[model samples]
Target: MKCKLVDVFTKQKMSGNGLTIFYDYDVLSQNKMLSLTQEMRQFESIFVSEVLSKSSVRAKIFTVEEELDFAGHPIIGLAGHLHEESGDVNPRTWQIVLNKKSVKVKTKKSGDYFYASMAQGKPEFISILSENDKHAVLRALNLTSENLADYPLEVISTGLPYLIVPIISGIEKARILLPNFEDLLANFGAKFVYIIDIGNFEGRTWDNLGAVEDIATGSAAGPTAAYLTKHQLASVNKPIIISQGRFLGRDSEIEAYVEAKDNVITNIWISGDVAKVANIDFV
Candidate 1:
């Protein structure tokens, strides 16, 4: 099978989150998908058994660890790739439906790059620990309670769970998180530290907590957007652009919009920027 590899979010190659898209994986098994993800050696890889439906596209996404219910970067990247090959010239809207959920991506042609927007569904904000436990979460990240933004800590989900850290508004101060490893993996049931989100504009995060540092974390960003929007800290209809992979020099940018009303997240969108880099044939 021939797989299309793309980077989601950044126009430059290798800067954004890496996504491997395989066409027609209806015959592939979960175990096969896991192996393929391992082989690709990227943060996340996606496979679509089919594409282009009336409302959306059905697909599956995989990381080195497990098959996620949904993922952000892969979905956006998939849309970008589809936007190119969809054979629908002057296409305005596209949707990619995964086994877990679905997202709608819209695009417009710029001078050289295409501007794409993905509509993430209503967020599911669940499971909040007490204030003490929340404080412990900061400790897990090697920071103090003073590091977080005002109010109680929140565990928010758009399609996944993330412990949102609102810290000092600069990446320089946000890059010092080290996991207690077990607590982060076993206790919180999440593997990403999303912050570097200071005031309203910037975001910094560390992925692959107990392992390698992820240059860009798309899955983590979804939950982050939800958390920020839920607390009345962030508003809907405003563009929230976060920078990831900067610490690693990949310098990826994840652009998303919030749709919140009355202290609730109605919808979220994470856009993808794909410029085809390499084409390869697998034997």
Candidate 2:
């Protein structure tokens, strides 16, 4: 199979997160996709089939460990891949029906960079974290309660659940060994903890959870935006601009806008810029 590997969320080579694309997926199988993702060993990979219907783009996103319902970088990178295969992807708005659920994605190309957006499913404010649990999370980041901003440490999800903590400054402030990482995991029932530094750098993040750092997180961003809107931490019912991944120097950006009625959030959407990389051929 011929596959194109492209980076998402940046304008230049090797800047954004990388996702490999297989334009022809007739040869695709769930087993093969999983095996190939293991072989590629990238953070994530994708396979895109020709759109059979007007409403859906046939595609699958795979991580090294498992399959994902929908992912940010893959859709952005795959949409750019399709734009090159087709022409002027102008409705630019499209939806991908994955096995998990269907999500909407849209893209626009300017010069070498392509900007894309995806509609995150309804936000789920799963739980409000406890003070000790919050302290454990703070211990992981080596920050005391005083260092973080004054906000409730909340768990939210548009797709994947994450513990979103509001912190004060850069990764320097957010990066430290988690004294009770395992306990936090056991107590919270979450795989990832995302500490978002909302004000200083717009949307810059300093993540040390999941035993590793994550480059791009679209689903997590959606619910966090909703939480911010609901708490009046950011302007409600308006698009919130967040710039992430700069602390790691990949300089990626994810912009999320929320639609809220009264105090309830109705919808959340995320947008970012991407770039196309060379296609790869595997024997």
Candidate 3:
């Protein structure tokens, strides 16, 4: 099997979140895909198969842990790779069908990078964390009430539900302090937690076990944008620039645009640049 490595959310190679994408991957089993994702040591990997047409394909995403219903960078990176393979200079849109839903991504070939934008659709405002749950989450994240911003720590989902923890400062000091952090979020209906620096629009998130910190989280960007717009911190219909991966030295920039009508968020779009890396062949 052959897989291609690409960096998402950055124009420069080796600067963004690295993703491994396997094309024509229907031959691989789910267990094998999971193993491959673990072997690659990437935050996530995407398998593309069942290409119905030039603009549509079936995709499955897997982390070192398990398969995901939907994700952000994987779809964007997969679309970028498809654009490169098309060898067309003009921009194109692709429909990537995942287990949960189908995502539409627009891809354009830039000078040295492929720019992809995904339509994450409407944001679902889930439940607000109660006072006690909030305290527990803050404890697990090693944060205190003082570190929080005036905004409410809420749960939001575009594809994956994330607990949006807004903080004014101390982003660098944040880390997962509990092994049951995932369980802690489960009680609040969150699959993961995104600790965001509202002052700087930067954010960070780690695996459930806190074993690894994600470089750039496109999955969380849509919710973060919605949270900002809902609180009137970000302008609706304007691009919100999110910064991430700086602490790990792989600086990445994600742009999110939120459209609202009558105080209701209608659409959320996440975009980033992708740089192609080397291809790997597995025996």
| TM-score of every prediction relative to native | 0.84, 0.85, 0.98
State each model's CA lDDT, in order. Answer: 0.68, 0.71, 0.92
177 Cα displacement, candidate 1 (Å): 8.1
How would you order the candidates by TM-score, starting with the best?
A: 3, 2, 1
Clashes of 1: 3
lDDT of 3 by residue, 1-283 (tens): 7689999999999899999998777888889999999998989999988888979999899999999999999988999999998999999999999987999999999998999999999999999988888888888888999999987889999999999999997898899999888888888889999998988899999889999899999999999999998888889989999999999999999999998888788889999999999888888
lDDT of 2 by residue, 1-283 (tens): 7888777777788876777887666677788888998787667788877686754678888777678776666776776666666667464777777767777777776787777778786788788878887887777767787767788888777777777778776455566476556456557755456777756534433233344345666666786787777767787667676666665676666778887677677778787777777867788
- On lDDT, the candidate that comes out on top is 3
Displacement of residue 265 (Cα, Å) in model 2 is 1.8
Q: Name the Cα RMSD for model 2.
A: 3.0
Question: After superposing candidate 3, which stretches have Cα over 4 Å from the reference?
Answer: none
- Candidate 1 Cα outliers beyond 4 Å, as residue runs: 52-55, 169-192, 204-209, 261-264
> Which residue window of length 10 is worst by lDDT in model 2?
201-210
The reply for model 2, stretches above 4 Å from the true place, is 23-32, 38-41, 173-183, 201-211
Question: Candidate 3: minimum summed lDDT over ten consecutive residues — where?
Answer: 21-30
Candidate closest to the true structure, highest TM-score: 3
